[model samples]
Target: MARTLHLGAFLHGVGHHSAAWRHPESAAERLGDIAFFEESARVAEKGLLDAVFFADGHSVNRTYTAGTTWFLEPITALSAMARATSHIGLVTTVSSSFWTPFHAARMLASLDHISGGRAGANIVTSMFDAEARNHGFDALPAHAERYARAAEFVEALTALWDSWGEDALLVDR
Candidate 1:
């Protein structure tokens, strides 16, 4: 197979750099606007980009005075993005530490159906004690434990995703 480069826009709030929101051309105010996300997806598609990815978090670890942080839940935001573009893949980070495999599988499966199979995921074990606290952990789990949970999470999601047969959702009797 021939090697090819894959480019995905990070599509962070305003921009990746903390100071980007201060730029004259930056659409900082449009962070929560669906049109902003839709327009961004359109632009990436027009550029022939391969995908647009959104990173997510469960808790606020950074002060707003310091820098921009992502607000929209990745799956929800990407679900909206899925509606605005035809070809660009919609990818997002999903924390295995916080989300159950069944929930992740259900949401991603819907996204895949919505986007004509352009949905993708970057599963993560997550970082920060704040995020851990939000999910009911007293602190971040040990590294080995987190990785082991992540592995199991992936296995469960894969099983859930592949569990259905073609007729699973059949309406015709």
Candidate 2:
């Protein structure tokens, strides 16, 4: 059997560069448009890509002076994208440091069901102080502490995901 290479597109605010929004060809004003995301995902699917990924943060990055700074929530945006494409996977960055395990598990599980198992999550311990503040932390936790919490968070999330048996959702009507 031959090995296969997987390619995933990281959709970040019109483009990846901070100045992406300033480019004449960029859809700067339509960053929040579901149609834009749907089109991008469709294009990625046309190229036979494995997945489309979105990175998310709770707080705005103050460093960017001129660029698309805000965005639709990742899972929410991906749900819409899932409806527009059939084969490509939908993945999003979910900050373990900010979201409770139950919430994360339910959201991911729902997305997984929606996409017929094409949903993926990149769980992250957020690095920004602003994100911490938004989550009610006065300062970012120490690196080790954050990782420790992340480990526990992942364990709990996995347990929650596993709690539902394979046949749990059987609709026998």
Candidate 3:
């Protein structure tokens, strides 16, 4: 058997460069449009990529004036993308620091079902003080603390995701 290389498209607004929004052909102004996201996913699918990844931040950075800084919520946007494409995986950044394990598990599980198991979660221990403040923290936790919390979050989330056995949702009537 031959090994296969999996590829993922990181779909950041237009491009990943800070000045991508300034490019003449960039669709920077359409960051909030679901159609824009759908098109991006479709293009990724056309390329035979295994997944399209969406990065997310919970707070508005001060750099907003320089370029495109915000976008549609990741999980919500991925739901639309799931509807728009098949075969390509849908993955989103979700901060363990800002969300409860239950919330994350439920959302991811729903997205997984929606995409026929093509959904993925890119969990992060967020480092921004602004993200901390938005989640009710006065300051960002120490790196070790953040990682510790992330470990627990992942453990709990995995348990929740596994709570449902594979045949739990059988639909015989």
lDDT, candidate 2, 39-141, per-residue tens:
9999999999999999888888777434765489999889999999998999999887888999999999999989889999999998789888887888788
User: Against the hidden reference, what TM-scores do the models get?
Assistant: 0.93, 0.94, 0.92
Q: Give the lDDT of residue 173 in candidate 1.
A: 80
Q: Which one is best on lDDT?
A: 2
Better of 1 and 2 by TM-score: 2
The segments of candidate 2 whose C-alpha lies over 4 angstroms from its true place after superposition are 64-66, 169-173
TM-score of 2: 0.94
Best by TM-score: 2
Worst 10 residues of 2 by lDDT: 61-70
Would you list the C-alpha lDDT of every candidate in the order shown? Answer: 0.87, 0.89, 0.87
The alpha-carbon lDDT assigned to residue 166 of candidate 1 equals 75
Comparing 2 and 3 on lDDT, the stronger one: 2
- Candidate 3 stretches with Cα past 4 Å from truth are 63-65, 170-173
Prediction 1 TM-score vs. true: 0.93
To one decimal, what is the Cα RMSD in angstroms of model 2 from the true structure?
1.6
User: What CA root-mean-square deviation does each model show from the true structure?
Assistant: 1.8, 1.6, 1.8
> Measured by C-alpha RMSD in angstroms, how accurate is candidate 1?
1.8
